[model samples]
Target: MKQVLSLWIGWRFYMARQSNRFISFISFASTAGIALGVAVLIIALSAMNGFERELEQRLLGVVPHGELTGVNEPIHQWQNIAQDASLIDGIVAAAPFVRISGLIQKPGGFQGLSVVGIQPDLEAKVSSIAQFMPKQSWQALAQGDKNNIVLGKGLADSLGLAIGDTLSLYTPSMGATKAQRIGAAKSHRFIVAGIFEIGGEMDLGTAYVPMDYAADILGLGDGVSGVRIKVDDVFAAPRLIRDLGYSQQQYMYLSDWTRTQGHLYQDIQLVRAVMYLVLALVIAVACFNIVSTLVMAVRDKQSEIAILLTMGMAKATVMGIFVVQGALNGILGCLIGGALGVLVALNLSSIASSIEQMLSVQLLSADVYFIDFLPSQLVLQDVALVISLALCMSLLSTIYPAWKASRVHPAMALAGR
Candidate 1:
């Protein structure tokens, strides 16, 4: 019966506090602050989740999970090595590649990039770039045209190249007798048979041709520079590469996506951690304002507190009254903020596109990042955790003010009133 009475009086006091204009204003401000902070935090977390998704699908999708590059020379038995690599437990597929450090002529200057030679059918099993490319563009390489090449749209556009356009690929090498002096530069002419766009810098710095052509030009004698490996689990690629390496008795240089693209993943994770810490502090600050609101209410209602004490109300009952009153503000804020956050998170990508179109500005550029637009994924876990955290902070903030209200002497409080 006492507990029920406390709850009734607590709710009444919460509703009655609006009579004090200043206290009312402070309470409103506190609730608004919590709402705003929670909404922004939710939006930020959703953006990070979206970026992580793109990292896996767009970037890692095209780049091989791992590779085994022959040391100082091409691997002559690449076919057998690829077959052996595919037999490993974690390894999914493997394909031979011939890499050339070459330059393409462009508008009175030259652009340097990696010109890789790949077999279309084998490449399909190991790399997803083929999936995004047109069948004609990807299969053109299999026709075995030493003079044919395929490159990214970004690279082709920068060099003013298109299908059927002839371009020159050149490599600088040293002369005989261990001389570092300038030597004969070998150059090959290639006709652009296809152009692919993967929406990344790889498009601007990489090209592909027939593996046989690359081997012939480099004098590798039917050998490939490396065998690119695809694995079922991306995170497991590093250790799996070592296992694949030990299976083959050759001394080769092992590499993984973690080596080439690990920094991007690290950066995303760092930003996410920072967002959580800073936003939690923001919510804490908002909750602390509840302390101030309750303090003023206790002072304003001193005579009422005195009357209740004289009527034999327990000190604990008085404490519970103020705690409930203060906590009411937190509940409203969490509910409103959480609802708004969910609505915005669901439409974030389209909203971003609309803003970009209206402002004529690009938020994300494919040249700089893996993706070119905002992405969001609403996770119930994040929502529940954020709301629970805010609610806990709100409850904690009420303790001091409620205790202070409970300690007021009935006679002293009545005399002051």
Candidate 2:
């Protein structure tokens, strides 16, 4: 019965429409502060989540998860090594590959490129190159057509290359004879088969050709530069590469995505941690408004508190009343903020696109940023955590005011009224 009475009093105090204007204003401010804090926190965290997803899907999707390479030369038995690696636990796919630094030239332009060689059919299992490439282009490569090659969109743009345009790929090396020193570079002709856009530095630096062509150019007689491995768990690639025993082999070496792309993931995590800390402070500051609101409420309701105590109200009940009242404010703020945050977070990408179109400005430039567009992904866990933190802070803020109200002497409070 006492619990029910305390709840009723708390509700009444919270719903009192005739309260002092200043007190009511402070209460409203408290609620609004909490709402703003929670909304901002949710939006920020959602953006971080979106960035991580983009990194995984767009960038990592094309890069090899792991690699097994020979120490001194090409892996001559790559086909057998690939077969062996694919049977290991956690490894989903393995494909032989060759990578070399080469220069690509058109009529009036030239650029350095990381030339990659892939078997189209086997490469499909290990990377998303096929998805970004046109159907006919990949099909041509799969059918053992050696005159074709694929270039990244940025690289193609730089060289003004298009499908069916012939380009020259050259690698500089020491000539075997003194007479050959004048032109100690080997050149190969290839038609541009396709252009792919992954929206990062890779698009500006990488090119692909058929594995057989690469073997001929690199002077590998039935050998590959390495075996690329794709695994079920991306984060475990480094450990999995070690488990494959490549590290123990005197003639082999192990490499994973961590070597090349781990810094991006680490930077994202660091930014996330800093944002969480800063936004949590925002919520904490907002909770201070609850303290202000409760303090004013206690002052205005002193006479009522005195009368209740005279009527045998327990001190604990007096404290419960304010706690309930302050908590209601926190709850209402969380609900409003959570709903708005979730709606915004889910559609942030579209919103950003609209803004960019209207303003005629690029928010995320591919050259400057890892991704080309803003992204967001609403996470229920983040929303719940924000609300829980706000509630805890709100409850704590009410304590001092509630205790002051409980300590009010009936004689003094009533006499002042």
Candidate 3:
């Protein structure tokens, strides 16, 4: 019965009349601040989640999870190594590849690129390039024509190239003498059979040709540059490759996706972590308003508190009243903010597009960034964490003011009244 009375009194104080307008307004502001802070945090974290997802699915999708390379020369026994790798526990698929970095020249421009040679049929098992490339283009690549090559969309765009255009490739080869070294540069002509856009930096810097053609150009003589391996779990590629004992053998080395693009992923996580701490501070600042609100409430209700104490109400009950009143504000803010954040997160992509259209600006440029648009992916765990943290902060803010209210002396409070 005492608890019920305390709760009723708390509710009544929260909805107090206009004469306590200052306290009520402060409470409302506190609620609004918490709501805004929580909403922003959720939206920001969700955007980070979206970016991480796209990086894994789009960019890493085309890049091999791991590669087994020869230290001294090309892997001539790649077929047998690939077969052996397939039998490993974590490895899902393997494909042979020849990669050579050189300059590609066209009519008006030249660009440096890594030209990769892949067996058309075996390529599908290792990567999803076909899904991003035109069906007819991949078919052209499978024709075993050594004179044809595929260009990345960015590379093609920069060179103003289209299908059927011929480009010259220059590769520097080893020579015994200094004069021979300068003169030993080999140049090959290839027709552009296809152009592919993987929607990121890969499109601007990589190309593909038939393995036999690449072998002939490099004088590899049936040897492949390396074997690309796809594992059941992408992140575990390094550990799995190491366990296979290939790296310890002579003339062999291991490389995984982490070596090249891991830094970008680490950057994403760092930003996400920093933002979480910053937004948490924002929430703490907002919760400070709850302290101010309750402080003013305790001051204004001093006479009432004195009368209650004189009527034999316990000090703990007095504390509970103020705690409940302050907690109500936090609960309300959390509910409103959580709902709004989820709604915004769910439609973030469409909202970003609309904003871009209205402003006539590209927020994320395909040429400059990995992805061309804003993306958001709402995670329930993130949402729950934000709400819980906000509530805890708000609840803690009530402690000092509630304790102050509990210590109200009947004689002193009534004397002031």
| Model number with the top lDDT | 1
Q: Per-residue lDDT tens digits of candidate 3, residues 48-155?
A: 999999888887888888888878888887878777786788898889898888877756766678999898789888888888889878887776645778888877
- Could you tell me which 10 consecutive residues in candidate 2 have the lowest summed lDDT? 173-182
Candidate 3 ranges with C-alpha deviation above 4 Å: 106-109, 173-184, 245-250, 365-368
Worst 10 residues of 3 by lDDT: 243-252
TM-score of each: 0.90, 0.91, 0.91
Error of 1 at 312 (Å): 3.3
Which segments of model 1 are wrong by more than 4 Å? Answer: 1-7, 173-183
lDDT of each: 0.87, 0.84, 0.86
> What residue pairs are clashing in model 3?
none
User: What is candidate 2's lDDT per residue for 106-191, written digit by digit as tens?
Assistant: 55766677888889889999999788878887876764447678888877887778898987878776344767633787777888
Which scores better on lDDT, 1 or 2?
Answer: 1
lDDT value, residue 395 of candidate 2? 88
User: Model 1 over residues 1-417: C-alpha lDDT tens digits?
Assistant: 878887899999989978999999999988998898788788888889888887888789888899999997779998888778867888999999999997777888878889889998889888888866678888888976456788888888888888999988878653434353225567788899999887767788888899888888888887899999999999999999998888877789999999999999999999999999999899999998999999999999999999999999999999999999989989988988888888899899999999999999999886798777888988889989889999999999999999999999999998884
